[model samples]
Target: MTIKNIIISGASRGIGFELAKQLCAENHQVIALSRNITPLQALALPNLHPICFDLQDQDAYKGLVAYLTEKQLSVDVLINNAGKIINKPFEDLGLQDWQEVYATNVFGVAELTKSVLPFMNKEGHVVTVSSMGGVQGSMKFPGLAAYSSSKGAVITLTELLAEEYKETGPAFNVLALGAVQTEMLNEAFPGYKAPVSAAEMASYIKHFAMTGQQFYNGKLLQVANTTP
Candidate 1:
């Protein structure tokens, strides 16, 4: 059967917005979420539904499960595409720094997955967007300590779900991608060097989200052009 309903986080802009736009173009119902009270005008597609809510809000997801439950929203796919990276030295990373990253990157994804699990079909797919730093530890970068660690946590979480969901596991995978041209990078670093178009990454991610691998859960697939 053709999967129809897809729920994506971080759909305000960047890869998330692009993916939502493309998927909706293909006629899939997309429930887009982000940490903003303001609606995302970027997703003007016919099948896109935007929810303006911040991940840091304590009661943001309180009634989410119940709402999905009441609506019987059968999610064919869940894309955990939300995250942030703070560039700074390890010592410079403070408590608020860690909280900020985890709140959006780790905690939000984990909570949203939990909220949507009951509504997700057994054969559905769960795709999390991780970074190349998650795979290699990114020791070369000065400001990626917290960012890299958060991604590592995401990877670890994906592995656990892969093992636990063996029988009825949602087909899962982590896209360890390279640079993508988006507001995320520019916002994090006003003068960063790594450059890649977000549109390309969105195209790749949208394709994979539709094609679920039966045995590739917890595996990290790198997508950097620098590699020959």
Candidate 2:
């Protein structure tokens, strides 16, 4: 397999952590970004580069760009996997709750994508991870008013990005995931068991991030077997 420079967000745990580990193990140049980098740093893989990054911080984008420039690494794949979810009833949800979720899930995605576009070319792929609850007509969950809506926003953002960059190059797509046995899942739904494990889902996402652009662009692929 060809080694490519890949960047992924939310790499401290769950699917994101697994994805970063898998890619680095494959000898790919993987830059794993998360607010907490200790987990990734502990791995000490030569190919894995961990950066402390908070998606909600606008200034962090400049640091990322500087690092890429200093390393002279042009990104081949960018996986916007960082997300925030709030499980609160619609009536009980406050404006701050909505802002916090959207800040990470939506605004952060858009900003990061924009920041990395210069490092990508026609061959580059941008994969934004969404949720099944975000899909139109999908079964709706009561406590995810803010979470689901924030996720939905990224789906549209991905489509618009794909269109705008269609002629220039780097393809964009969004993956609307189903229930996965992740810490996030446990937080969202206590005592629910998801059929998919983080490593399993990470493996699938790794494959897609590397090759899915060949067949898909401006598309929303549902990657779930069951809803939570």
Candidate 3:
């Protein structure tokens, strides 16, 4: 396996945190981004660098890009794991609620990735973590209308990126994950037991983030035993 410098968004907890932990254990440089990085800072891993700021903050985004440029950092893998889910019925979902979800889930990912592209290695991979509900024909659950719509947008965004970068260097792909046990999942489906654990999902994401582009480019992979 090849180990290289990687950047992970939304890494203060859950799948993102686990990914940072595992990757840092392997001696890869992991730049973990989150709105609150106190939990990450508590880990105290030398290889784990935590940056605290909302992805929607343009100043924070520019600061990150500047830091990378000043340090001459070349990201080998960029994982867009940061996301926000709004669980409200379609009618109850206000415009602000939808905007908040899309702001972090879609626009944030796009802005961060765009800023990093100039600093990414030619053979690097850009992986976005989406949801199974975003997939076409997937079973739809009520109250997740906004969340699902944002993820669906991400899938299409990733597909278009794959095509746009086909003849280019860095490969783009999206992982449509099924129900995974995490704080977010628990909040989304209160008391429901998800088939996959956060650790399991993190391990799979680590593998794909490290090597999926070798076998796939512009692909939407489903990482769950059950779909929808």
Best lDDT among the predictions, by candidate number: 2
- Candidate 2: segments with Cα more than 4 A from true spot: none
Better lDDT candidate (1, 3) = 3
In candidate 1, position 66 carries an lDDT of: 59
**TM-score for all models, in order of appearance:** 0.91, 0.98, 0.97
Off by over 4 Å in 3: none
Q: How many clashes show up per model?
A: 3, 0, 0
Arranged by lDDT with the best first, the candidates are: 2, 3, 1
What is the alpha-carbon RMSD of candidate 3 to the true structure?
1.0
lDDT for each residue of candidate 1 in 123-219, tens digit (9 for 90 to 100): 7889999887777644345688888888888888888887788687676678877777788888877877665788888998888888756556667
TM-score of model 1 vs. true structure: 0.91
What lDDT score goes with residue 158 in model 2?
94
Quality of model 1 by C-alpha lDDT: 0.79
lDDT of all the models against the reference?
Answer: 0.79, 0.93, 0.91
lDDT of 2 by residue, 84-114 (tens): 8788889999989988999999999999999
- Clashes, model 2: 0
Predictions ranked by TM-score, top down?
A: 2, 3, 1
Error of 3 at 55 (Å): 1.3
